[model samples]
Target: MEFSNRTRTGTHDSHRTEHDATRPGPMEEAAAVMRCIVCGHRAGYNRAVVDLATGSEVGGLCVGCECTAFGVSLLFGFRLSGSNCAFCERDGHYAIPSWRARTVETGGKTVSTVEYDVTEVTVRLCDEHLERLKRVAAAHARVPGSVRPSGPE
Candidate 1:
């Protein structure tokens, strides 16, 4: 199945109020189908993978939930799971959705769109690599022109 950065409703553990500040995509349909086993937000999720905690396998998580709730970003909207690391043979711990964006001229205005890379992979990473990648992503977000996730606008 395909895994995208779409959020679903219905949470699993978190009691915090629902927050869907970002934009929505085609995965909106998934929100009605599955709920997050962690936050219980009743948002969208991935049905292709299994939820290691309950083994329900119905839905996984969205990109925002993956970051705020789990601290592990998703890669191309995919919820990372499995056993081994994509970089090394060691066990995996974290996943990042290494998304790309670019501003283009559309209708005489600049529009930014999230784009995917050709080599994007939904592989897990060890703590060592995940930490490093998180650090780099953080640093990159600090740079000017970088798109960083902000609170509800």
Candidate 2:
């Protein structure tokens, strides 16, 4: 059976079905017909990833959304050159850096230093994904014992 991008109203569990070598599997067919979550574009060519955490398909990621959803993750000394989202492999639009800060006693005085922990990491986020990421980060920040001390007493 041929599949097309259509808004399925009722709840349906996307299942996989085996097919002959000449035909595509059920999962493959579903992916081809999936629509983008942000733009509602028919993602026949630009298939998005499935959010395992939420058990739903995500589609139509613009550069901003792709960047926000994936973000970048690189070593401290590395450089970024690509415009792809690190998490979703979509085009990225931003380069956001994450830092790690530490405070230490220097010459009997307290001094603070910041390290670019995610030096190569870039931030590319769409409006939706950016807002979602920010919300999640804020939630984590509010949790007790979520942030750990960098130095020992």
Candidate 3:
């Protein structure tokens, strides 16, 4: 979500406040590193290089049991179609990197450098998956509305 600091005069004192929009934030981008929405398990993943070949899943089981269940939902085409992280398989959690292609003029020559920027996307979990996430989170001491748990488990 887009956040902006707003300053307004309220009667006597000038107040500065932060306003959040309906948008994805940096935490979502970082969390997309390889988290399973169904169970909140995170692991390293090797991304698929070509579309023709199916990706490989070799990581250990996630903390949540419903991850496998979610996989079943995805298998029969029951999932609502949308793009998700290739690793975590959760939509909106991953931030698609944007490549900036441009050139700058040097003292006497032209130099080009590609810049990469990561933008987070808001992914919507299916109802069942969301509920499972909530239960798993609660079990792990994670609070609702707060994505990160308060302390080390």
Using TM-score as the measure, the top candidate is 1
- Model 1, C-alpha of 97: deviation from truth (Å): 10
User: Candidate 3 — what's its lDDT?
Assistant: 0.32
Clashing pairs in 3: 1-23, 1-24, 92-123
Alpha carbon lDDT of each predicted model: 0.42, 0.38, 0.32
Give candidate 2 regions above 4 Å deviation: 1-80, 97-123, 148-153
Question: Candidate 3, after superposition: displacement of residue 51 in Å?
Answer: 24
> Please, what are the lDDT tens digits per residue for candidate 2 over residues 21-99?
3465443464446553443344332323333234243453333333333433222333444545444566543333432
Measured with C-alpha atoms, the lDDT of residue 143 in candidate 1 is 64
Q: Could you tell me the lDDT of residue 144 within candidate 2?
A: 82
lDDT of 2: 0.38
Candidate 1 weakest lDDT stretch, 10 residues: 7-16
lDDT of 1 by residue, 1-153 (tens): 223542222222222225542435333343445553333345333322332233234333434444543344343344434566666877654333333444556555444444222122555557666555446554654568854344322
**Candidate 1 similarity to native, TM-score:** 0.33
Query: Which regions of candidate 1 fall more than 4 Å away from where they truly are?
Result: 1-82, 95-122
| Residue 131 error, candidate 2, Å | 2.3
Best by lDDT: 1
Candidate 3, 1-153: lDDT as tens digits: 221111111121122134332332332233245444334455212110111122222121232333322334432434323455433565433222222344555554444333332223212343344455547654654444533322212
